[model samples]
Target: MGRIAVIGAGMGAMAAAARLAVAGHRVVVYERAATYGGAVRRFERDGFTFDTGPGLLPLPAVYRDLFVKTGKEPLEACVELVQVDPSSRHVFAEGTEVDLPNASRAGVVTALDEALGAGAGARWGDFLVRAREAWDRTRRPLLEEPLWPNWSVLAEREPYPSVPHKKLLRTRRATTLAEVGAWELRDPRLTALLESHALAHGLDPRVAPASAAVLPYMEHAFGTWYVRGGIRELARAVYERCVARRVEFVFGAEVTGIVEKDGRATGVELADGEVADADFVVAGVAPGALDTLVPGTALRGGDEIAPQRGAPSRLTVLLALRGGRPEGVAHRTVVHAADRTEELDRLFGERPGFSSSPTVTVSRPDDPALAPGAEHEAVTLSVTVPSGLSVSEADVEGVLGVAERAIPGLRDRLLWHEVRTPADFAEETAADGGAVPAPALAAADGGLLHASNTTRMPGLFVVGGWAHPGGGLPHAGMSGALVSGLIVEGPQFRGSQ
Candidate 1:
């Protein structure tokens, strides 16, 4: 049995630890923080709780598969996974609102048509059909398998089948997500709806590849889910699973460097100057941190995909409200900005800053565990912001203003609110500029692809949001699976069968 030393206790690292332990390897996880679940954190106050990280889970089958492979107990046995119906409600700037049903294409189409106009829903439905084609084309290469050696093939060729649009007496196809919205969806409200998905991932729809259509497609195909307590519960379950598999975790023991001998990673150097010897090293950290650990050794070949950098982060506001969450309210609501162009320009333009009318997502879960009682409610408002921006009071107020559209009298209803800036994210995840990683897409000239899990260094692998398959809850889990597969099965490993 090989001895494995994991550099972080994040979900991806923990996932790998559990699988490796079950495979009879002695795995030791060293986490800088006192707790696990890197970005998936929780906040508690006055009997109220809030998930400071991702509020929803898409493609829960990833976790279910993780549990089934690592142990006999199913994921459902460990946590209450509830499928959120009426998946989301969209409140457009023009005051048009639509409630989309969960995983029901017909329902979503019908609702969009009823709310926007006669033909809007059909346009979106047709777009979804095309998006499905994109998903089917790239699902295996992008998510289920390790990033291929010739990843440029996936990067250079756009998987999304864009409809031909004739303009200026010439035929053209949508290339970017913004083009997809403008050419295919047609309706302004529908365009807003389309781009909102990209915005939620900290992606600039104006520049994100057309292949990013897979983002919304994944949600529509699998459905959106909520853990009864909060997303942090999923982290707890994963950590517990690691312990159950006999994986050892050393909390608050920060790793200082990677010990190398004879040109191979042999162990890790802790902050206390103690070296923990192991046969293999799995680093679940951001690209910048990884470089500091290995020092002068180049982790990737010049021809390999370079590590992605400069991704945008998020600004979240947790609201503890006074009134009971009204029945029939959609669990999630997206409030579109008054000016899409202005918001996009502010967020992704050369000088990134907060938008006065930034697009905001408001999540009001019905779970009682999040609040003191039925008489009170807990809500979270999140918006995409440029990474490392110094936040001010005006920025927070602007976000609250946008959220007012989702919750009437939001200011009055809000008993107290706490803001989490990108700075907080930096401290929590150790990522440069508190930047959040987006899921890897199939196109965009390789701009969206992450670094490969298997690096140039032997006996060393990368996992988590910063590595192959990219970020998001499901992608992180898949990263863990891919790393374990590569380590256990060696160079012949092609991913899970």
Candidate 2:
């Protein structure tokens, strides 16, 4: 069996390690942090537990596949996921509330009809059908594969050559979420609501690709879920599974370099001066960090990792409220700006260090595990801000002011708050610039310059949000599985051929 060294213990690292271990390869994971789950981690303060990261889990099947492959059932390990009834509630500046239901094609149309206006539902339905068509067409060909410099491999798998290629190419040029929504929905409110999901990715709606509209379809079709205890529980489950499979975990061990010989990965050198050798190495760290590993030489010789510009990071504030749940609010609430264009102009155009009227997500208050009794409520507020910008004391105060305006009595409700800036995220995750790297093709340059293309590196592979499929827990986990399959299947295919 081939010995493997996996760097980073995020979802990507965990998934890769677990899969390889079960496949009979001896696997060792080196994580910089004391705990697992990289960005999807939880932090506790004053008896209040905050998720501190990703608040929603959509696409349960992806996780189910992981559990099944690892010889365990997801439901048996995790709590039964209760799909958020109204998937999300959008609050406009005019105080109008639009509740999007977790429903089917027709049901979603009806919901949109009721929320937006007459005939708007039909338009939404039509848009969704097209989005679903895109989903069906692209699921296997584009999403499932390792999208690197080679377009021929993806092109050969496309069901319809011309249409898929055009659509895929169009995604590269899209700049904002609003531009994408415009191609589908006519209602302004519906458009805004549809554009909100892009915000989760730290993207502007106005220039985001039309293909992004498929995200809502994926959410509605697969449904959004929350783990009973907390999202971190899912990470813990994966970590335990890795342990059961005898995947050696080395926490607080930061990998500072990737050793190369004859233009191929040999092993890794830790920051603490320990060297671990392996047959293959999968990097679950940031793409920008790769420069520290191998420095400017593409494993594939001609291919390179591109640097994307204009992708923003987030400013997150976790508040430990003094009391129980506030009246008339769901688990998730999005407060839209009174003047969105102006606000976005300041946020994206001026490249503000902070945000105004940012989206806020409040987890379930009934969970006593997170807070003792009902006296305290844990809520998290996340605002998209430009990457590389610092959150000064004034910037933090400014964000607090916006939070007060968005939520009634927000200042009074909070017992205390912990603030995390992009700089903080950068320092915490060790990602270069503290910003999640987007495909340069998807961002400013509209060229495939900035993205971690794993195939470009022979024995060295990358997974998670930094890699081709993009961020989010689902995609991150999927990327891990894909890399594992590549390692496990690569030899078998070669032998067969």
Predicted structure with the largest lDDT when compared to the true one? 1
- Give lDDT for model 1: 0.92
Q: Give lDDT tens digits, candidate 2, residues 1-497.
A: 89899988888779888988999999999888898888877878678887877777888777777888887666446555667767766776676776677756677777777767788888777767766765776565345555545543332332211122135446332233464455446567777777776666766666555555567778878887777667888888889889989999998888888887887888999998888998999888775666677767443333344434346787788888887776655667777666667656766785464444555444443356787657778777777777777777677666666556446687888778888778877876677556764421222222322244354557888777777566778877777777887788872321111
lDDT (C-alpha) at residue 403 in model 1? 90
Which 10 consecutive residues of model 1 have the lowest summed lDDT?
295-304
Question: Where is model 2 more than 4 Å wrong at Cα?
Answer: 152-177, 299-310, 326-328, 350-352, 359-366, 397-406, 437-457, 491-497
Error of 2 at 425 (Å): 1.1
lDDT of 1 at 263: 84
TM-score of 2: 0.87
What digit string (tens of lDDT, one per residue) describes model 1 on residues 435-488?
A: 999999988889899999988778899999989899999999999999999888
